[model samples]
Target: MMRRERLRTSESPDGRKVATWRLVRSGARILRVQDRADASPAYRWPGREPLPLGAPGLVLFDELAPPDLATVREAFPGCLDLWNAVREDFWHALLDTSDLPASGTKG
Candidate 1:
């Protein structure tokens, strides 16, 4: 089946470290990730809609800066792409191996 890897930011200029969890599941599997820290009072709401598949990555900021979509895009290119690519690859592999679906469908 699919193999998942968790990734975190090495460092940020503001000293905030972003944490992410990656899931590699069958194409048929659905995964979701959330950022509880973002929901806390310390962050400025970005008004951005939650990702269609939910956030597969969680980021923790040390301060109350508004959400920077651009910075997020630049910082976690691989992680963002992994959400779909990894899942597709794993799903195909699993399908090739067996008829059963993935057990861990949610992130």
Candidate 2:
């Protein structure tokens, strides 16, 4: 089976970056564009597993750090619909988890 991996980056309070290469074994709902968004356009496999939290890791950025829809779309075409769907899902999920009504509906 072809192994799929995802890159996750987090910054510490200080001016340091830590990158993690997560082994995304399987997830049907996980969007493919997420991979493009997390890593640079010329991303390549690091040839090894990520280091521990205390250890250093390589940090990579997409074409744009905080990519806008246009940037993301430009990087990977035909992702507009997918992006919108994911955004809507996240919005609704946030509302549901926060126990908030769906705007027009009263709880």
Candidate 3:
């Protein structure tokens, strides 16, 4: 299975943080890091706001499942490379987007 997950984060010039994720394909119960990108943190929670991690090596995702184009678009609207990566790399069979809302709208 291939997973697109947070790898690391960096502080932007303005003191805000930018998170980056990598696409990893795992076969034997192991995850190997692949492609990566830094994107705006626009993923949401129903009632809680996203906060900075209190420690290192912590992980969070906008969606627990494979990220849909809309979710990515919300965070990084003009990123063509990110669009292509989500379109081509993530294995849809491993994803269940039925529980997700339609793309381009808020949760």
Backbone clashes in each candidate structure, one number apiece?
2, 0, 0
How good is model 3 by TM-score? 0.29
lDDT by residue for model 2 (1-107), tens: 22232233222223232222222322112212323233333332222333243122332233222343334345545445554544454344434434434568645
Ranking by lDDT: 3, 1, 2
TM-score of each: 0.21, 0.27, 0.29
lDDT of each: 0.35, 0.34, 0.37
Residue range with the least summed lDDT across 10 consecutive positions in model 3: 27-36
**Please, what are the lDDT tens digits per residue for candidate 1 over residues 9-107?**
222323233333222332222222233334422321234343444433343332323223335545446445444443444444545644443676542
- Candidate 3 per-residue C-alpha lDDT over 1-107 given as tens digits, one digit per residue, 9 for 90 to 100: 21233242232234333334443343111111112233433223332354464233222444445343455446445454444444443444226455355689655
RMSD each, Å = 11.9, 15.0, 13.6
Q: Where does candidate 3 stray beyond 4 Å?
A: 1-48, 54-67, 91-107
Q: What are the runs in model 1 whose C-alpha is more than 4 Å off?
A: 1-27, 34-79, 99-107
lDDT, model 2, position 98: 41
Overall local distance difference test of candidate 3 = 0.37
Error of 3 at 33 (Å): 14
